[model samples]
Target: MNGTEYRDHRLFKGTVTERGIIDYILSLDESLRLNYNAYQTIVFTVTHRKPNLFRSFIHEKQRGLSAKMDQALKTFRQSEIAIVNALSYDYSNGLVEGINNKIKIIKRTAHGYRNFSNFRNRIFIEYKLLETKTAA
Candidate 1:
């Protein structure tokens, strides 16, 4: 009924397949259809936890998702194992990196440290290593 309402509909806003248009449009040729399907499959495989299937999805059926898509596929092919690990694993080093950055900032703020002992004590207090000292 309204602009936003119309845009929210699957036909107007969702993927071509979800709109029921890409099904017929992309199905015109075997190669073209395969390319389209492979692209969609890869997109889903990367975002979802399907490491087992990602290898086949990328290397097996990915023929050509148009000219532009071929380059992207090539990149994925080169890092196939990494891509699979990313999709399948639930771990990330982001937290460790963030903590490292915080430590760097604290060290930078304390300008003149002459010895390792002073630096070590400062780091311990910064991280609240001694509960008694921190409580006071």
Candidate 2:
């Protein structure tokens, strides 16, 4: 899959959970070592904006501040490296954000979904449909 597609997948999300997203990201290239902290800062900022999700994932299992900090530090080190290499490239995190907004718009437009499966299908279908149109 393309970068955008790769970023949007639940498998990638799971990787973020399992291996830590920053580790996976840094593994993509060794040149990414310089700006790792910057990338982590952005990620931490975004996570703060979604406190519920953050709390649910990291803190729910009684994992305290120390564990969280260690994880964040490990992820940040690699992320800083990745961001350094990414500096020269004019990549927009906007695409992923835009896709998220589009998904919200879809849910709102359709008055929300009844179940997770349907929600997943709807999003997958919507993405595929948009991809087809763009390809054409």
Winner by lDDT = 1
Model 2 residue pairs with clashes: 32-81, 32-82, 33-81, 34-81, 35-80, 35-84, 36-79, 36-80, 36-81, 37-80
Tens-place lDDT per residue, model 2, 1-136, is 1332233446564323433565678677655633454345447645455433333333333222344455764564556545443543456689999899989988888897889877877888888853323454
- Give candidate 1's error at residue 128 in angstroms: 1.9
Candidates' C-alpha lDDT: 0.70, 0.56
Count of backbone collisions in candidate 2: 10
lDDT of 1 by residue, 1-136 (tens): 1222223344455533343555556667877887777777777777777887877766764444676677777888899888878887889899999879877886799786889777777777767884434454
Q: TM-scores for all candidates?
A: 0.53, 0.30
Best by TM-score: 1
Lowest summed lDDT across 10 adjacent residues in model 1 is found at 1-10
In candidate 1, clashing pairs total: 0
